[model samples]
Target chain A: MPLVNRVKELRARHHLTQGDLAAKVGVTRQTIISLEKGSYTPSLMLAMQIARVFEEPVEFIFTIEEETE
Target chain B: MKRVIIQSLSSIILYILMAFTIASFASTVTHSLAALKSGVFVLEFNFLPFLLLIIFFVVWTIYSFRTRPNQQMGFGQWSVRMTEFSEVDEREALITAKATKAAYVSFSISVPLFMLTFFFYPLFQTAWPTYPVFALVSTLIIANLVYMTTWIRAYTR
Candidate 1:
């Protein structure tokens, strides 16, 4: 199952650049790009870090993508 | 990613140089042995080129393995030390794992193919005693190339 995330949306809402979030989350900017594009999945620690950055819970930021088929 | 590219290119050059150095050293030893068997006691080997090649190869190896000065790497952190598996971040680590898997797969397939060539060794023994050395070096070269290609593709994608 694909992992759906609202990283881009939340990042925009918070006025955080990709680099900013990556630094805040202790990841490379490329990782943020991948996460935003739904091409990469984060580890639980990374998920928690990102969630902490946005002052939100992990579930609010990420969800298991439902199958449309 | 840039560092990975540089490391890959440097590794390629290092392997090539290593091949040349090994071949040259082998040739020198073989010729010296042949001359000794012939009772030609007057040894006239020009060691300058061979020595220079060895020196250069050693220097290049050191340079290729050295990490960036600003990069704080722990000695016990094998993942961080591994050029193919740069674990500076979790995502990079994941990409490195993928690349390492690709390299391992390539190596697993290539080793048997290379070993198959050993069957022909009897035919080339006298003609090319250094075949095994070259084969080993080529295997490393191929693995490095595979790893680099996979890493670049994954990272870019």
Candidate 2:
């Protein structure tokens, strides 16, 4: 993925399991695991949902991680 | 909780039922050893074997009903763990087309074998053959054509 997110850190902060986060975002727990592992990208709605769960703006939670030249 | 419990109950019951059926079949085969080798495989159809089989099945089913899981499953319960399986893009379409071509070649190669079977069956028997031979022949033809067509179509846009 080209973007980085504070999903794991935020989840830790809230003491939430991936299952809990997945439930909050209306997705399967595997989806949450995949997101944290950078093995799969979330849809726009899922991204919004994740932001809502962390109580942060989308930009605050996720940002493009540009490669160094 | 209810849904998970139900699913586990059903699965366990099914497994138990399967085991009971196997055990009953084994007992019947043991009792009918003399009959089994002498003729076409027919069970003695005796009451003891039948009752034993039924009892075994029922016992397992009742056991499953009592022992099923009551806990909730995690999210991975429904989703496949492997990511490499089942491609989701245009490359998959191309691979599908290649497989279809292979299926067509296999079918075409098999047609002569079916025809040969029909050509040879008549030499063995003076009388008309049974419906099973004709049914088998036609099914082979139909299956090949269907497989070829479907496999070929999967590649097209």
Candidate 3:
């Protein structure tokens, strides 16, 4: 199940790498890698903060796909 | 690697101490007069513990050298400098649960085998299975504990 996220795109829009996003989000680059790799799902608070980082809604930044059910 | 080194050194020291204690006890357990009756008692001290200790040291040395520590943070690619950890997230916890479940399953499986060895095989040897059985069961338990702690540390950090 894909935990679809605008993380990469949003970060790209803001000219940020995974490391930059990770520093802003208070986590490790590997965490960003895990998030991007769909190996781990971020906490709601982290998701919300990630959305805030990109100046987007939580839904806009991260959306659950069908298989997540 | 540091943790593994520390654990190896400590377990080595402990095994040496145990070996020494076991050997010393054989001579000291009986009176000096009783020792004389069992002619050559003091002189015929068994070198079993010394032999076992040497074997353990060699095997452990090889095993320790072969076993790599699993610290992933040393790669220097991480973004955050995590200094504290108080809890784990659900996902990591689930992974920990999986490992712990494996240990529990392994432990449960050990019980029957333990009974077989303790009772059924008391007077006989069964392919030298006891040591391997003990090693495997204990290693599983220890690995599960490591997994659970690492999982907890992962997110709480």
Candidate 4:
């Protein structure tokens, strides 16, 4: 994924388990893990839902990585 | 839990009935072929097996229709509801799509190989009359299995 995310850090800050965060966001725990691992990108709605769960802007949690090239 | 059990039971029954029907038909065909070879062209038509097959089909159809998801309780509706309830979220969906793509690529490669085998059967003498059909079915089954296993493992991790 070209986008970087601090989902793990933010989730840790909120003291929420992956399952808990997933439940809050109305998704599966595997989705939360994938988000943290950067193996999968969330849809706009999912991104907004995750951001809402963390009480932060979507940009705060996810950012586009600078292209080294 | 009860619903799950019932759904599982119905699926099992349906598959069992299908297998039984197929086996019976195959055996009947074999018997007919043997009789033809012996100069006895008499063909026996067993009504009981056909009747049983029809009854099973009707029962299964009704069961499936009754379980469907929606305001009305039907098998199709129930299955739809179950699928929606168990469907992977977006992340797993992405993984599943990738796995499916991989399976399709594998299938594409296999198709040419199957065609070659079919065309070269006379030269190689390795292709039995039914080999091509069985090979095609096997390829499809393997591809689906690969996709399912890959996605399931990815999602679980």
Which candidate has the top score in lDDT?
Answer: 1
Candidate 1 on B1-157: residue-level lDDT in tens? 7778777776776677666677767787778888889987544455655676668667754554465533464445523454545667888888889998988999998899999999999999998888888899888888898998888898888
What TM-score does each of the candidates earn? 0.85, 0.34, 0.51, 0.64
* Tens digit of per-residue lDDT, candidate 3, span B36-64: 79775554455666676677767655554
Order the numbered candidates by lDDT, best leading.
1, 4, 3, 2
lDDT of 2 at A56: 95
- Model 3 achieves a DockQ score of 0.28
Q: What does candidate 4's lDDT look like per residue over B43-103, in tens digits?
A: 6655565677678768766665565433365555454543212234666557657667867
Tell me which of candidates 2 and 3 scores higher on TM-score.
Answer: 3
**TM-score of the second chain of model 1 compared to its true counterpart:** 0.79
Steric clash pairs (candidate 3)? A29-B79
- For model 4, the superposed segments whose C-alpha errors exceed 4 Å read A67-69, B1-34, B41-74, B78-86, B122-127
Off by over 4 Å in 1: A67-69, B42-70, B73-80
Best by DockQ: 1
Give DockQ: model 1: 0.80
Off by over 4 Å in 2: A67-69, B1-157
| Candidate 2 global lDDT | 0.55
Chain B TM-scores of the candidates: 0.79, 0.29, 0.34, 0.50
- Give the residue spans of candidate 3 off by over 4 A: A67-69, B1-94, B125-157
Separate DockQ for every predicted complex: 0.80, 0.06, 0.28, 0.46
lDDT (C-alpha, whole model) for all candidates = 0.81, 0.55, 0.57, 0.66
